[model samples]
Target: MPEFSRLEPHVVAEILRICETMLDEFDQSYKHSFRLTDVHGFGDFDSAQQLAADYRRKAAGTPESARERMQQFIDALTQLRD
Candidate 1:
């Protein structure tokens, strides 16, 4: 596999944090039946769908990058293990 170097660890952490927050909001919104009383205009299905898609894209990208990092880490660890 190709080496992974574009994303720094701190940037990945930040992205993961944002994705977690968005996922939590999406979960809460669904549980409450998309109640507008608590979230104003953000309770609509379309808004939620868009946010979900955006979050998914970011999350997938982050995971792919992280996977590369993790593979590299594993390879390095394996060298020690052997």
Candidate 2:
């Protein structure tokens, strides 16, 4: 496969667009639900509330951070047009 640097501008733009859409649509939706996930096998919590909070942080943090990073990529890629 060709390296990303070798890809045409349109290809890169389209890839970014598609990725942004996926992040907005699927990723955004799943992230909300991700916070609802159970914290299984991590350890026994002193309370269910603590377990829920821990699960919320672990499950929701990654995708949300990734979404932000993707937005940064999109922004930088867009500036390549300048």
Top candidate, metric lDDT: 2
User: Tens digits of per-residue lDDT for model 2 on 5-25?
Assistant: 577888979887876765566
Instruction: Report the lDDT tens digits of candidate 1 across residue range 1-82.
Output: 7776587888878876765665565455434532322323345699786776554454334545333344444555444333
Instruction: Name model 2 segments beyond 4 Å from true.
Output: 1-5, 34-82
Q: How much is 63 displaced in model 1, in angstroms?
A: 28
Give the whole-model CA lDDT for all candidates, comma-separated. Answer: 0.51, 0.59
